[model samples]
Target chain A: MARQQRGIRTRRTILEAAGAVFDEHGYAATTIAMVLERAEVTKGALYFHFPSKESLARAVLAERPPLETVPVRPCKLQEMVDVTFVLACRLLDDPLLKGGVRLAVDQCAPQSVDHAGLFRRWADHLTWLLRQAREQGELLPSVDPRETVEMLVGSLAGIQLMSRALTERADLAHRVAVMWSHVLPSIAVPGLLPRIDAASDRGSRVTEDLG
Target chain B: MARQQRGIRTRRTILEAAGAVFDEHGYAATTIAMVLERAEVTKGALYFHFPSKESLARAVLAERPPLETVPVRPCKLQEMVDVTFVLACRLLDDPLLKGGVRLAVDQCAPQSVDHAGLFRRWADHLTWLLRQAREQGELLPSVDPRETVEMLVGSLAGIQLMSRALTERADLAHRVAVMWSHVLPSIAVPGLLPRIDAASDRGSRVTEDLG
Candidate 1:
């Protein structure tokens, strides 16, 4: 059991290292030698864990920590929206995840449907959440849930891309939350506006106090 | 005078050739030698027209076709919008320009500010049009012009990105016109919806019959 545990740890280490390398050097430029060098593992050991570079890259791109490992739990629509907001904020804060995002946005070829498919996954995730929002009476009946999700994700991605250009991390999260507050209400149910508005007021006050 | 005219023609040839090479090979991967070979011009001739690779690239990105070349006059805001719509359709149809767009998007790097600046130029162009729309009383009085412009541009670009993923042509202008029919009513002057609805109907017919 101890030997098995050590083997798993080594495998995880190699995967993370490969992710970083690919994100930096791109898939075409990254090499197995670089991965082995970063992981401080022999070629044989690396081969023992992964058969090929393509498989390794797929692992990195597809890596997801199980929900049970995180504090996240299934919840109501409003709660899911709140959780999604927090998760998006957390994703912006995570160092390892940032490279993957940059790779997807700036490096991935639009001509490659496989790469585009990877992006559609994020849209799919947002679609699922939007459907929940609709079911919970949190959204307007006239709203096309798919388009709302698209606008939300696409606008946030655009905002993050712009923020990354600004080269300043100061107050990014607060600004993003405020932006979300303004955007969220567009599709949200009219009756819930007061609750969302009050929450947004508090957010703005916090922003002012932070300044 | 004759020699000067010849110089202008040579410069245009070099720029066109350079744009093609850059679109095919991308920025980092493309070499001066490759550009020279493709243009059938010597290094001296290439340098005479453009001093450096960076300057050449900036020219390729910054190239704007003559406004007079477009079909519609831009004197009135409505005419300006019509002209802009026509140009947007033409841009997606042009093979060479589409290639340049591919090059521009694919060349984007997280560390690079140039690509962001390019998108800023796009936003700036759209903002200018929206300001014209406001002056003409086409926009709602309560709308924050900048935010409206951002959403319109963001949504159009997002749609184009998705469309390009699915199809060969980047024909987003008509779809945007359709979207604007619904979206403009939300943010346009009360009486403006009929005009927009007509435009939307026209665009849909164009897509159905032509596309």
Candidate 2:
């Protein structure tokens, strides 16, 4: 069991190092040697966990930092907002999430990995939360959960991309808050609108609470 | 004059070929040789026009499709929607615009070129129209023109990107329409809301009228 734990730690170290390199240099420019150097691990040790750069990228892409860090609230709409806020916060500070998003959006990423899958999974998660919101009468009767999920996912992607390009993502949480402020009024029922918080600092607060 | 015109035509041809290649293969995978082959121009001719692949990518990035295809309407809000609709339509069919977007989003594009400039330009244009909308009392007094422009550009980019990744851009116009439907209700005053037409076919109509 101790040996297994050590292996797990070593694998995680390599993944984090690889993600950092990929985030800074992008997929095309990244090399396994860079990962090994960053990880400060022997080539054989790195190869044991990730055989190739593609696999390392795939591993990085697969690593989704937990969104459940935020405690669940009675209002699913607020919970959904919390998820995005927390994600924005993590994306700003976490190399793994940053690298994953960069790789997922990168057109030069390995062809075998389905970058769209990440977006689809996010949509699915949001769809489930939205359905919960609908059942609780938090959402407007006119709202279609699927379409809203797509818009949320897509718009968030765009907001993050723009923030990254323009501000190096320093203002991602603010941009996301602004996005939700515009979108939520159209989707949420009037009764629930006032109750949900879409503040820019919501992400940092959640992270603070988690810490 | 004739010699200058031929030079202009040759440069245009090289740019088109380069744009198509960039759109299909992305920045890292593309090569001058592939562009030469696609354009069926001699290496010397291609080199004379665009000295390097970076220059070719830059030339492609510099090409902006005219968004003035839609006639300016009495309602600046409607005109803004028309701009997006027309762009959505153009992005669906125009390789140059598509490639430009791809390259601009591409992190690997030459660092010297400003990728955010495109978004900034769009925001600037939208800000001007939004200012007009504000002056004409088309927008709610609470609406911030700059924030609105950033959201519009970012969300449209997200919508288009989602459409491209998921549906290969088949539903971009519809997605744009949906985005506007959600966004316009929040920014436009109650009186002006009914005047704005956010329809999937609005793009094609604008294109036909322009033609």
Predictions' DockQ, in order: 0.27, 0.74
> All predictions: root-mean-square deviation over Cα?
5.7, 1.3
Off by over 4 Å in 2: none
Worst 10 residues of 1 chain B by lDDT: B66-75
Kindly provide the TM-score of model 2 when superposed on the true structure, using C-alpha atoms.
Answer: 0.97
For every model shown, what is its TM-score relative to the native structure?
0.71, 0.97
* Tens digits of per-residue lDDT for model 2, B27-128: 888999999999888999999988888888878877765665579888899899899988888887787888888887777776776666777778898999
Query: Candidate 1: which pairs clash?
Result: none
For each candidate in the order shown, give its overall lDDT on alpha carbons.
Answer: 0.56, 0.85
| Cα-lDDT of candidate 2 | 0.85
After superposition, candidate 1 runs with Cα above 4 Å error: A21-53, A65-84, A106-113, A136-142, A168-186, A194-211, B33-44, B65-88, B95-100, B103-113, B132-143, B147-158, B169-171, B174-186, B189-194, B197-211
> How well is each residue in B1-211 modelled by candidate 1, as lDDT tens digits?
9999988888877777777776565665657787788788879989998887777776666666322343332333344345345445655545345434544454242233264455566667667767877777777666666665555554444455555554533545544454444355556576765554326334334334444
Candidate 1, position A112, lDDT? 36
